[model samples]
Target chain A: MQFDVRLFALYRERAGASIVTIDLPEGASAGDLTAAVRADYPRLAPPEVRIVVAVNAEYADDDQLLQPGDEVCLIPPVSGGC
Target chain B: MIILTDEPLDPVAVTDSVRRDGNGAVVTFLGTTRDNFGGKEVTRLEYEAYDVMAIKKLQEVRDTLRADYGIEDIAIAHRTGRVDVGHISLVVAVASPHRVQAFEACHEAVNRIKTIVPIWKKEWFADGSRWVACEDHEFADEAEHAHAHAERHAVAAGD
Candidate 1:
């Protein structure tokens, strides 16, 4: 299955691209997607940066399963000033 | 409660929208454009949004507050487009039987909006502009991790 992932804020800057398309095997979980992102993009590896993932506009946990055509977004730390 | 606007926000109107006779306490929070962020002098602010997500998230916050506090009425409005210094960018109002609930609900509403909403602000300084994201309590660590991850990937890619 194929999923379209969005990178926002600093992630967008780091990726140098706003969107990335990832191909995952059947029955992939959010964790699988994260690992793929880390492996492919390299900018996603640990020290385990907390990147919030939204699947089709709803927040999803790492263990959440991904369906085909789900809109995935990697939300970086927001910069709302104090 | 209505949660969106492109025009300048009116705090009085937002407050009035939620006022009730049984509710003795009404708390309103107005987030305005400031002239400075850190050391940079902000001339103005430009707000953008993934409108669909922003509105949905704003409504979710309103619903959560209503459920958690037993708040009767609430209103949340956020301004988009160019807003000059001191102009209101966001407004949140809540009314309840007691002052404590009103205050607490209002505070939580605004905090949730800032943290979860998809709205983005670009601070235009004299020299340049930068996009602002919602800052969380654990922002520094998250930023460091994101930076390191990106750097490692870049190195592997031989960029």
Candidate 2:
């Protein structure tokens, strides 16, 4: 299965690609995809960084099941407004 | 009027969006780029947002205000791209029949935007630049959050 993971903020800067697709084995969880990306883009963040992945615009659990073409997003710590 | 614009945000237009016959009180809040942070001379601020999700969160903020305060005519405009010092970057406008609800709702709306919206603020000073935290008050590279975000949420889930 292929997972389209969207990147933002620091991840975007480090990965240099806003959206990257990861190929995973069948029945891999969201956590598995996150680990794959962390391995692929080791420089995306320091070793201490563990990125949260969102599925279909909402934060998803590590064990959440995958679906084809689900809108997945990486959320960075956000600070906005007055 | 929940929006994220790269152009200069117009306070008057956003305020105008919420005006209606029954609304007597219109409360508007403008967030401007400041020239200083931690007493350091700052140049300009760059703002970014996750457009689709940000709008969804803005709508959620609008719904919360309507349900909690019974105010429907509410508008929020946020600026993206580069915002100069002394320029308006955020506008929260709310119209209500009573002055109190307008004030209260508008106040809560700004807070919600800060809390929920996936908007990031980066400040540039003469020496360097850093991303500001919404509530954590940490000086670490705000952008560095990409790496630690999942772990942070793990702690949040535990809390």
Candidate 3:
């Protein structure tokens, strides 16, 4: 299956593209998508920071199963202004 | 009311929208772009958001506050794109029968927006620019802050 994942903020700036298409096997989980994104774009790797996955506009757990055509996003740490 | 605009925000309009004759207190919060950060002279601020998700999350904040505080009149407005220093970037307004709930809800509203909403802010300095709160340590700090906020909220709610 092909998933077109959306990127924003620092991730978008690092990836140099707003959207990237990833090829993943069917029945892949949201966690798998995150791994795939990092694998595809090595520059997106931030080992210390936890990048969250949002499936269809809601935060999705790692184990949550992904379906085709679902809106996926890579959410970086929000601006809390610490 | 939930608003996401690239244009400059009007706090008075948002506050007035939630005002009513029966309400005794109306609390408003305006988050402005500061002129400096960490002793670095800041030039401007640029905000970005996942628009659709941002609106949904903002509405969720309003709905949750209404349910928890029994306050129905609430409004939130956030600016997107370029916002210069001293400009308004966020506005949260809440009206209630008393001052306590109004103030608490308004405070909680801003916290919730910072945590859940998909808005991002970039700080521009004369030397360069940096994305605020993108660091790993900052995330950890925010988590701790959120934990503290949650505990305070629970205590305030008597939960």
Candidate 4:
């Protein structure tokens, strides 16, 4: 399965693109996508930092199964509130 | 009212939008761009967001506040794009029957928005710029500098 993972903030700048397409297995979970993104873009963030995955605009657990057309984005640490 | 806008946020209008006859207390919080950050002079701040998700998260924050504090009146407005120094970037207004609940709920709403909302800020200094809390390339260096500066300030105070 091919999934287009949306990147934001630092991830977007490091990757130099807003979206990156990756190929995964049929039953790949959200964790799998994270791993794949890390593998593809080593400079995106440090290994220790967790790359949060959001599906359909909500934070998804590691085990959440990603559908074909779900809105997937990588969220970095945020600093945007009053 | 929950809004993600590029235009300047009107605090008065946002506060008015949440006003009700039954509400006795209204608390409004505004987050503005500061000129200094960690000993560096910030020229301006730029914001970006995953718009669709940001709106959803703002709604979630409002709903959670109402559920937890029993405060039904809430309004949040956040700005995207460039915000100059000392300009308003965020406004959160809460109304409730009592002052305590309104204050508490408003505080919590800001905290929650910081954690969950899909918004990012970039601090532009005269020398360069870096995203706030990106935790990627520049954040580590900036963190160390901030820590060192803080320690220096503490030592100066002790002297």
Better-scoring candidate (lDDT), 1 or 4: 4
Query: Model 4 chain B, TM?
Result: 0.85
- Whole-model lDDT for model 3 versus the true structure? 0.81
lDDT of candidate model 1 versus the reference: 0.73
Candidate 1 per-residue lDDT over residues A1-82, each given as its tens digit: 9887987655676678888888999999887887888778886435445456778877678788999878888755333212
**lDDT of each residue in B1-159, candidate 4, tens digit only:** 998999999999999999999999999999999898767888999999999999998999999898999879999999999999989999999999889999999998988887778888888999988777422323235654533343233223212
Rank candidates, TM-score, best first.
Answer: 4, 3, 2, 1
| Regions of candidate 3 where Cα sits further than 4 Å from its true position | A80-82, B134-159
Would you give the TM-score of chain B in model 1? 0.84
Please count the clashing residue pairs in each candidate, in the order shown.
Answer: 8, 2, 0, 0
**Which candidate order results from sorting by DockQ in descending order?**
2, 4, 3, 1
User: In candidate 4 chain A, what residue range of length 10 has the lowest lDDT sum?
Assistant: A43-52
Show the colliding residue pairs in model 3: none
**TM-score of only chain B in every candidate structure:** 0.84, 0.87, 0.84, 0.85
- Which candidate number would show the highest DockQ if scored against the true structure? 2
lDDT score, candidate 4 = 0.83
